[model samples]
Target: MKRLWLIAAICTGAVLLAFAQTQQGSPTPQTFLLRYKGKPGDVSRYKSWFVMRMVGTMPTPAGLREGKMEYQSEATYLHKIISVAEDGTLEIETVKESGKARMGDGERMRDLPDRPYKRVVKMTNRGKVIESREFEDGEEEQESEEEVAEFPIASRRYQPTYWLDKLYETAVHNIAFPEQAIKVGDSWQEKVSEQMTPNCKVPITINSRFKELVKLDGKLCAVIQSEIDAPIDGQDNVGEWTVAVKGRFNALMTIYFDPELGDEVQAIDEARLVLEITLSGPNRPTLTITHRLISRGKTAKLD
Candidate 1:
């Protein structure tokens, strides 16, 4: 729908404007060390909302046609510090508290069946996942669009290393910072490779910058910006359909981190992507899909 595109456009513009305003020419000489230093038994409750709109054009038997799909959800999670290693690494266990989702077509949101999905992650103080494990406590719910949206962060059971970003890295501006003091205007880069499937490996570089300091809820928060522009295209053959796809995933992420508390206060992520697929053996039909997602999360700590 045109409305979805308009909303995406507006959000994209807002991201650019907000980042531009934080570009102070040459920040001061002072610096701060940012780390994840939660003690064992520390708990954090995070509440967030995810909205995604998909618009596409597909070739049907009749002719070329347009298609649209959208998903929106509100979810909650509880992250508890399981253990802290002597080397500053940590084991954190995250549990899905509740989730509610509905179709984007004016459908009212409803609760996802009451269930608890759990994940335990091991990472250094810089928020890089060294290991991740996901498990559910009960029987799997029937798969559906709403179910997929319910656990957008990590898979229910098996999880690849790259998928671990949804739990930690994205909340911290996608950076695995060096053990060094960082100042405003300082930037870092991390090269990452993600395995989408058994045969598909996508590689990307994440760019992060300490933009500036800001005040939120009367707390001085450090603003960090992250960006990802990666191309993920491949060819596949399934049953009698040969598919060739091309796409780029572009995302803009902003993090509001509390330096004194050594934790995050809020995070925002906006991603827009377009993919073109050509299917052979079926009159060489082509499809073009555009996807836009906006996510916002806030955190509260409980000891």
Candidate 2:
């Protein structure tokens, strides 16, 4: 009888050991189907900041001259969902709460007017822009020669208005997600084309991967990593000058998204670009410009 009891105890111990080994061998995978879940009257407040630095070298009659220019800007944006259709279309009103910029020799410009700038955007639930409109500021648009010549390459194309427009557009478009639910380690690709000017088109291809789902500021968030590649080659008329630009761009972006809210909580984008510019005139020397840009944005409850 003692031998029988000993045999029974050993059998129980062996079964327990086998169960533990099985548990350790198979780990559950982390996966989720991310979608936007929001309703009308939902409000989100966003703050964005960008810093850009450019170094250019141009050939001159005297010799080669090099110049450097830097620009920094910050803006607050308020987004309100006006209506949500059953089909998942959203009408959103975006207001520029405030903005300020600094350029040239590191002198901070005065703050923008107290009045809010406004824009209306229509988008789909999957982060596609259907339409967008910018309210007029009522001031006549004018460009001074001094402003045009400030930084020959960027001054003409990269203005405060352009930056602000791009910023709002990005916020409205958000991220391009996959059609089906994705799990960690899954990857996807998207193609984007934008008309930068009348004759210039910028084409970008992005590769994205789901990195992980982790807690951010006490909120569960999915982190996505993306790589952006764009090549630019176009000619466009800028005021009295016809400028030709050829460049290559590369960037990396990390986005923190709240799956429940269906919105981006935060994002960081860093890019490097190199361009060769040729103006439309005799004896015009080609200018080589290298630019670096960093942009960041965060969103929170309005109240």
- Whose lDDT is greatest here? 2
lDDT of 1 by residue, 209-230 (tens): 8899999887778888878766
Deviation (Å) of 55 in candidate 1:
1.7
Tell me each candidate's RMSD, in Å, in order: 9.3, 16.0
Which residue pairs collide in model 1, if any?
A: none
Q: Which candidate has the highest TM-score of all?
A: 1
After superposition, the stretches of candidate 1 with alpha carbons farther than 4 Å from their true spots are 1-28, 107-114, 137-174, 282-303
TM-score versus the correct structure, for each prediction:
0.72, 0.71
Could you tell me the C-alpha RMSD of candidate 2 in Å?
16.0
